[model samples]
Target: MTPTRRGPKKIDYVGAQSDGTKLAADLPAAVQVPDDAVAWTAVLGESTVRNLHSPDWKTREHALQAVMRSLGNARWNAERSPEDVWNTVTQLLDKALKDKVAPLYYASLELLSTLVATYSPNLPYGVLTQGLEPLMPTLLHRVGNNNARIQETSIQALLTLANQPALGLAFLAPHALSAIPKKSQSGAAAAIQMSGRLELITCMLNVQVQQQMGFGTAGRTPAAAAAAGKGGDALMAEDVVRFTRPALDMPDDKVRTAAVRLVAEVYRTRKAAGQPFEVEKMVGAGLKPALMQRLA
Candidate 1:
């Protein structure tokens, strides 16, 4: 008699019910699609939105992929009211960003990066701030994600958002400052998060300085661009004085180094812009002491 055959043991994955549900094929890469060919409505229909909330990971994953691929399509400009569409999709994105599955989480972040890169310039100020500002904390915290690639991707997303003219350095400064702790903690993980936040603040300031100096103004009229740059410069100067002093006292070497680099960059940017930065007056007595302590 043949030996009794054993069936494979059954194992259940939590939250992955209907895992075999068939979904539409993945959309083509965004670059493959002709610029003027597709509209936002066709790409993000009712079915795709429904799939994003599906219990099956693959369905949600595919839905996000479709949105990301079709995000750059040409018809966003023709929509009657983009605020309505932005609000709908951003709410979906908030949920998707918290997805437990790795692929889905990364896909959500990638979509966010694309969303900011593509729409920041075109969306109305109220709409852009309302839609994207709330996501800043999530992106900042994700910098400490265990996956290295995810960390890098999150930083790239933040940088992309920062570089946009619609949202200036001031918008991200509050989130970055709030993410770092007031009191230093005694763990490696805390240090890493602190370092990431500090580095992010530095990058944001660098982007702002570039903007204020007329480096990346592609579409705005010269007068409008100069006005926007001045607003950003004033806000950024305040933030530098607010945070750099405490950042220098952080326990991590990397965090301290980032703080020092941020200060140096501020001086360099102010000099290049032909703006006088009276460091003693702007940063006050506190920062000088902190810098002196760090040097010692």
Candidate 2:
């Protein structure tokens, strides 16, 4: 009789020492960091926040980087809760977001995304609701800014929130997308109501539609989960954000046209979702003329 072949057995992955002994983690029964270490970490966190508000862009950028690093460190984070750190830095974060300087905005966005990505497990679960959800409106508003750094970082920050199953699928998903159009403004002889618009439509794709493997588990609705399964191909409408105005003042027709396409896609999706849209009401709205001229 022919002998049946068997596949090799799988073994548990273990690091081996030079002596061929399996290595084990050298963890103490409990972390016993000294009082001075904790106090110093708190000081470092405070100093970093101070640097973020410095007048010099270099100083601001360096501070943001420092905050990002300190938040990501395991021992440092253990010393100070993420919520405490975030509360202390909230004002600085707000300033960074509002700063017209591209680098400051980019660093702020990166800092938020980096924290969720790096410290999700080590930090408390409340950061999602307490630390992140409160910042959603500001993040959504910035998504419409024409500046590349602001736009991309906004998208990245949103995606990071979407990845958290602990916060539930609705933490940062389609259910949360909504905004009112900025009222039209007049000329130099008249008061301007609202002049700012957008040239930005980065992506509605939520790459962070990932699985929940943490403490406070949160999952998406069936529809949201189904849409997420399609990944990048998910219709941009799957995650809609109301646009207050168009971003088409750019001289380059190619750029304007691209912006128009983004707006058209967004408008179509927004309508399908039954959300309010006033871009068509604005005469200078970039999406309007682009669509009309093409039809004519």
Estimated TM-score per prediction? 0.69, 0.50
Task: Please tell me which predicted candidate would have the highest TM-score against the true structure.
Answer: 1
Query: In candidate 2, which residue pairs clash?
Result: 165-218, 198-247, 199-247
Model 2 Cα lDDT, one tens digit per residue, 74-131:
7877787666666545534554565555566677788877766664544544444566
List runs of model 2 lying over 4 Å from the truth. Answer: 1-46, 122-127, 174-176, 181-296
Alpha-carbon error at 245 in model 2, in Å? 15
lDDT of 1 by residue, 1-296 (tens): 89997632222122222222222233332212222222333536656765665556777788888877766666743553556557656766665665556677678888887777767666766677788766765677667554567677778787776566666554555566663543324567666666666666676676666666678742233333343344334235556646676667777677778877777777777678787776666555654475754433
How large is the C-alpha RMSD of every model relative to the true structure? 9.2, 18.1
- For this target, which candidate reaches the highest lDDT against the unseen true structure? 1
Candidate 1 positional error at 179, Å: 5.4
Model 1, stretches more than 4 Å misplaced? 1-43, 74-81, 179-186, 218-235, 271-296
